[model samples]
Target chain A: MITGMDRLAAAIQGKKSDRIPVFCNLIDQGAKELGMPLKEYYSNGENVAEAQLKMRERFGYDNVWSLFYVGKEAELLGCKELIYAKDGPPNVADFVIKTHDDIHRLEVPDDISAHPAFQETLKCLRILKSEVGGKQAICAYVTASMTLPALLMGMDRWMELFMLGPASVRDELLEKCSDFFRKEITAYRNAGADVCVYANAFGSTDFVPMRLFRELSLPQMEKDLKPVGIDGVVYYCGGARMNAVLEQVIDRLGIGAYYLSPLDNISEGKKIIGNRALTCGVINDIMLIGWTMQEVRDEVRRMLDAGMPGGKFLFGTLVMPYNIPEENIRAMLETAYEYGACVEEATS
Target chain B: MLEDVITAYNEAVFDTDRERALKVIHDAVDRGVSPEDVVFKVVIPAIEQMIKSISESFDANLAQHFMTSQIAAEVTEEMLARFRKAPEVVGHIVIGTAQGDLHSLGKRIVIGCLKSLMIDVTDLGVNVPPEKFVDEAVARNAQVIGISAMMVHTARGENGCIMVRELLRKRGLEDRIKIIVGGAPYRYDLELYKTVGADASADDGITAGRVIAGLIKEVRR
Candidate 1:
């Protein structure tokens, strides 16, 4: 019997694993169900380690990330943070480093490890690596440069600039953000992250046009992520098709995975880039949003049936489902454990 | 530039040289083009086309919604700049994004379209405290107060209007300043606009402009 981590490693490495890898992200609710507070888990290394173990044991998923989000980053970055009580994601206070002139004020850290968020991610990754090392893959969660800068600039005003900034202004800001992420990725890898997952929130055209999208964002991965051998995964919540043009992206960088996104033409996406690197994710939202236990099993089974035909599959959402029902989450974990293993090739 | 702008706008649905597209309107207005005709035939249908596109899974890398918004803002600002130099348009409207919300794209779009048509617009940027909305409405003597919400969670912030009405304690003035609401989230529940104490709401800029134009005409009469 293969362990979950070993199975996931086999899958990413394109080898025969016992089962498919279950690598879904976690939210605070799942942690509290096991007696960990969201805030404490973030700051206290012991609490974070406990929560990571609980997530692994309960869900039986393959990878446990160093759970770093923008909130802690915001708090650590001298931004006002609104702490929520038992509900909602904690929010950053209203302060922005808006405009091109403000860009000059943007500080790229010296040695980068000095940032609290970076420190926390490193500490959490060390614990996860110690606990899950060689057993399952450990991911260091990182935001895309375009997104981190936008948040730091204040989400509202940054959004306004998307409509206002010229190609040059947008590129400049994205580059700064990219620079920040790249610096952090190297830092994250040093702290024990096997792969740094890049979460780019705004590449969706539901809000931005493609021209600026390409100019401002497309080349960021390679320029920023390549130096550390850091494998990149672009994860956005609602699917956006612009991501499919990996020819330009992958040519410049090492893109290891694409999270489950409806925007990508999964079949075509697999055909285009799956042969080049590890291709994972295609779990549907309906399965996790409001489906029954059997229905959830059937959904994962369906993805396994449909998406796994060519190989290199990782099981999960495109964007991690925040505040998902724990029952459904556990049901998903069970489904992955029960059915996600690899088999002999027809005994040829 | 025009060709790329059109392709980007048409392809993404949200892409348009709002400045150039609205130029057609401003030019028409400059040469005595009927505001109603320019709006109904040109701007209305075009933006409606865009509204349809955004409604159909628009993306920044794949679709051009935000840039379209930028164009809209520039066109609106240009028109407003031009309009300030001209004769009074005899209309005043206040606009804002609801509280606990900072998205200004949709509001900026609506404000831009109104400004291009030579209407007066006072934009209260995102996460506006309700008192400020009411305060701005009273101070501007706005004929209509417009509110926009883009996300489902942010729609909860529309509770600011009820706060405004209650804080003012005058349904007459509150009613006089007709509250208008619009955005992606509001599309599902038209009554949400009403529930938030808005007198009217439209899902897109065209209908919203038309609604405001009519409201202003009525107030002027």
Candidate 2:
């Protein structure tokens, strides 16, 4: 039996595995599996790890995440409060950088692992590593430099400063954000994160102009990834189509993997990526909330048909909705496993 | 002269140059342009055009949208105070994030655009329940309820627009108040608003202003 890690490795190396690897980014859905409050479930790393292991076993996906929530990164930086939802991920209530002066005062803790906000995350990573370290890929999320400030401040304010900038202020904030990003990626790597998802929605043309992406976002991303290196880092744009900049990311950052948005054309993505890096074709999981079983199966088959031809492709989801019916999820995975089987392997 | 002002204002807002945009508006007003004309003819049309011109850079252009909306609201407020007679508001609407969703940026942008378009807006803030959405729309005699949900779970969740739609039906307000939803999720699935029983959905703040205005007309009829 090929391990999940082996399957992903095969896909990454452009070799035919027994079947294509399916990655379910089930974050809040863990609470549903445990019948616990989302807040309580995410408050402790053991609970998150337990849920990840259980969900992986039940759903038979290829990866688990140590990401508590997107807001956890804000909490580590200085956010004082977070709003937890009954059926959604928590959000930062108190933005650390509320004013221009706050940016100057904001500090990236020298040792992020020592920060209280990151302790639970490290614990989750350590446990996932200990239990399924080499067999299953433990994914961790690291917000890229350009997008991290949006977490520190609100997105609206960040946009104002980023687009209509006093260059000094924008650069100052980006410098601090880059420092924090570099440190966070290093910590996640040290704690046994097999894949670091470099999340920067602004990196894609869907969010910014192509010129701005090259001039502003790309330089900061390059700087952030420089010291940490991009060996196992997968460039993600939060589910924004990144095909427009895929070549540039590969050429400049030399990232090993690319998580294409569901909005992106899978065939075009594969053609662009070629064999240079792994291409993950993400399903629009938001639609799963209302899509019929047949719809799910057909969509999964279509994505597999488009992505599986050229090797180095992985089937995945973009933050599985908590309200998605259990049967729908089953249908998606079952279809992936059935249709994603390599032709030669299935015939043999 | 109005055309020059509109052109200057459009270029300033599109550039995300707040200071320049304001200077253009203030200059136009100082030149004896009716406050109403400055708003309806200059600011509103300029913002609509900016949103129309946005193509692949929707997210990146948020800065432009934000500046345009903010400047429009400011100029409208200043102009409203100076109007020879109070300009008639086009319609009234209440807006907020769907329950369990705390995102407010999209809602804020919509409110700014609506205000400049002569639409009266009542913001109920984030994480507002369905009951509040319908109740406030009714109490305020609003023609439409705008729900913003940044996440899939919140956008399609039972407590989101779905519940608000249910509440409207229960209270027999369906004919009176229409529902419109906008957010990242709606952009991903264009027909999600229909699944959630919303009257319509818009892709951004500018389009939202137009959609809600049309819904307001429906309510009036």
Candidate 3:
């Protein structure tokens, strides 16, 4: 039997597979599937690993994640509190870098693998590696240096310092963040994560002006990724449209995969990406909350029609909402599998 | 003279030079420009123009918007103090992040823009509940309630704008106090305002001031 990893590898290498790989980015939804609170489900690697294995088994998707939550990254970097929610993903309750002085004081742990917050994450990765190891692709989330400060000090203050910078302070904070990112990426790769998603919302025009992206965000990201290399790295912009910068990112970063936002046109994205890297077309899962089963099926077909023509494309979803009915998910996956089949007749 | 001040202020703000932007207003004020004229004719229009210029890449220019609104609010505060007589307030609004939603950047941007637009805004802070939104709006006799929700669950969740709308209807205040929502979810789904029981929604904080002003007019009428 063809494994999920095989399909993913085939897609990445621009080779034909049984079907295009489907990545269901159901992070918090895992807790819902396990009949547990998000906090409890995420507190231990066993629970998270179980949830990932079970969800992938149930939905038959192609990828499992090692991401507990985005806020955990902040906790590893001195954020003292995280506000967990019953129905939503957790968020940073208190910014670690509350003031300029706090930025100076913030330190990326010298050995992040020993950090308490990351213990559960490493456990989860080990479990997934033990269970599915070579059969399924394991994704690890890493916030890029340019966007990590938003988690540390909140977006408002980060913007203030970034736009109205006393350059030395902002640069100092970014350097620290970049160092953390390098360590985090290296740690995850060593611990069995096959893919490290380099998430930087500011990389897209949706977050910063083109000039700022080129001058500030790009350079910081380049520095952060230089040590680890970009071979198994996937570039993401936090569900923001990135087609505007797709070519530039490809030219500069030489990243292996691009997770195109729902806002981006699949055809346009494929045209830009060409054979340079794998293109993952993400569905607007927020709309899935209200869309009917038929609507969901239609959207899946539409996306496949646009993205499946090329061999390097993968069908995916953004972080799905907890309220999306099981039937809608069923409809989405069923349609993806039905249309995504790689029979010569279907492909031709 | 006001046009020159507006041009200079726009340039300073576009460059994200807070000090230069403030100096432009201060110099205009020292040159016998009435504070009221400076605000109504110069500051507001400068912000409006800035919004138009950056409309294509609004999210990327958040820093610019944040700085522009902050400068506008500072200038408005100084001018309001120097007004020969109290300027006519355009409207009263209470705004905050919806319950279970702690994202405050959007709400802060909206509050800053509204303040300079002569809207008497009471910030309720983040993670505000339905009862608090209604109670505070009623207590302050505010014309509009603004809820910011960065996530879909909070935007359409039970304790978010939906519950706020439910409370207003239960208390017979729906007609008297209109609701306006701004955040990522609404921007992603334009018609979400109607679904969330809001009178209107805006793409960004600068446009939010105008949207709430319209809602306030509807409430008054």
Candidate 4:
């Protein structure tokens, strides 16, 4: 029997699989499913790991991607104002860098692995590796470099820097952000992750226009990601043109797979991505939560029909909504497995 | 002269030349360009051009957009200071992103729209508490309070839109102050308005401004 990891690896490498591996960029949904308060789940690695595994089992997810939230790496770097709430991921409470001069004092710890949040994430990866290991692909997550800076400075201030700051200042920040992410990717790879998923939400044309994405977001991402020898996937949300951006990242930057949002047409995305990389998704997170099970099943069948004919497709969601029902999630998975099954390649 | 200033402002901002953009605005004002005309004819057009380009799929780079917004914001402040009587206020509104949500790109865009429409807008900034929104609206005697929550948790969380609605009622100002909720969360489901007890919701700034105008009238009547 081919394991889920084998199937996913095969799909990513442009080989055939027996079925489309169905999972999601599921993190907080795990806590929501287990009825665990997000505050409790995010506070410790063991708790987060257990909740994720339980969610996978309950939802029949083929693979497990573990992440705490968007700003964990920043929190680890001595950002003091981390906000912990009742049932959602913690936010960077107050900005660490308030002025342009503060950029000079920014430092990356020599021993990143020693930071408590980093340690907790590694602990979660280790737990998942020990528990699921070869059976499920243990994917590690990191926020993309272009966006990680906003974790230290707020998003508005970061946008101000990108918009109004000097080119030298912007480049310096990009270099620092990329370097920190390099440390994060290295830590995740060293800790036994099967794949490292880099999230670049700002790269989407929805926020930063395509020109800035190409000039600022892309180069920084390529510089940071090119050194990582581990298999990598990208997550981006934007308008329809995002498919073209995904192609550049895969072809130019060497990412192996992409998790797309609903804004891009999957059929067009598959055509653009072709055999170069694996593609996993096109669901609107809002629809995942707001739509009924029947609506979920119908959309699942439609997406499966559109993408499963070719290789390198996985059934997934853009982002899982926090309040999404287990029944709706189960409906998505059931429909995918039933409708998304592919022909198994003959073994030697 | 208005056309010349608009073109100069457009090219200056698009080129990301903040100094040149500010110089043109000051020069315009020095040359007998009323502050209101500079706003309506030059600055507003420049910002509108950027927004139009973005919608048309032209790559109006992020920096240029922010730079143009900053110029427009500064000009709006100047216009309010110099000519409060020129453009009659359409309505008074208090706006901000909800508590626990620090993202403000959406709120800023909406603020720009409201300011351009000559509505008196007082921004409460990001991570604003629900009661703070009510208190600000009451202080300003504003007819509308527009709250933004971009993500799921912030849109529906305990201290989010739900909290804002209950707080407004608790303060006995629910009927007087209409709520217009927006951002990514409400764009997908207008039903969120009913859930959050907002009088209206809009997906974009122009629609938001128009909707808030109508909402103000409904509240006053």
Superior by lDDT: candidate 1 or candidate 4: 4
What's model 3's interface RMSD, roughly to a tenth of an angstrom?
Answer: 2.2
Candidate 2 lDDT at A71 equals: 88
Per-model TM values vs. the true structure: 0.74, 0.92, 0.95, 0.90
**What ranking of all candidate models by TM-score puts the best one first?**
3, 2, 4, 1
lDDT of candidate 3 over B22-76, digit per residue (tens)? 8998888889899989989988998778667656654535666688788888889
Q: Write the per-residue lDDT of candidate 4 for residues B47-78, one digit (tens) a residue.
A: 66765666676755445555666667777787
Better of 1 and 2 by TM-score: 2
Q: Which stretches of model 2 miss by more than 4 angstroms?
A: A165-167, A343-348, B1-8, B23-36, B51-60, B78-83
Number of clashes found in candidate 1: 20
- Candidate 1's residue-wise lDDT over A224-336, tens digit each? 56655545354443343434455555565556666646545566666666655655656654236456778878876766665566667767654334444677777777776
Deviation in Å, model 4, residue B32 alpha carbon:
5.0
DockQ of each: 0.24, 0.45, 0.54, 0.46
Native contact fraction per model = 0.28, 0.45, 0.49, 0.45
Chain B TM-scores per candidate, in order, are 0.65, 0.95, 0.94, 0.73
DockQ of 3: 0.54
Residue B74, model 4: lDDT of 72
Model 4 per-residue lDDT tens digits across residues A1-348: 777787787777656777778766678766665677877777788888888888777766667766788767777666866776665667778777887777887887766677766878878888999988988878776777788877888777787777777878877877887888888877777787777767666767656656667777777777877776536555554322367576667766776677776766788888877776777766766767778899989988888777765678887675576778768877888888888777444222
Q: Candidate 3, clashing residue pairs? A: A207-B60, A208-B60
Judging by DockQ, tell me the better candidate of 1 and 2. 2
Error of 4 at A81 (Å): 3.2
CAPRI classification of candidate 1 = acceptable
Backbone clashes in each candidate structure, one number apiece?
20, 1, 2, 1
Candidate 2: residue A220 Cα off by (Å): 1.4
| Residue B184, model 4, lDDT | 75
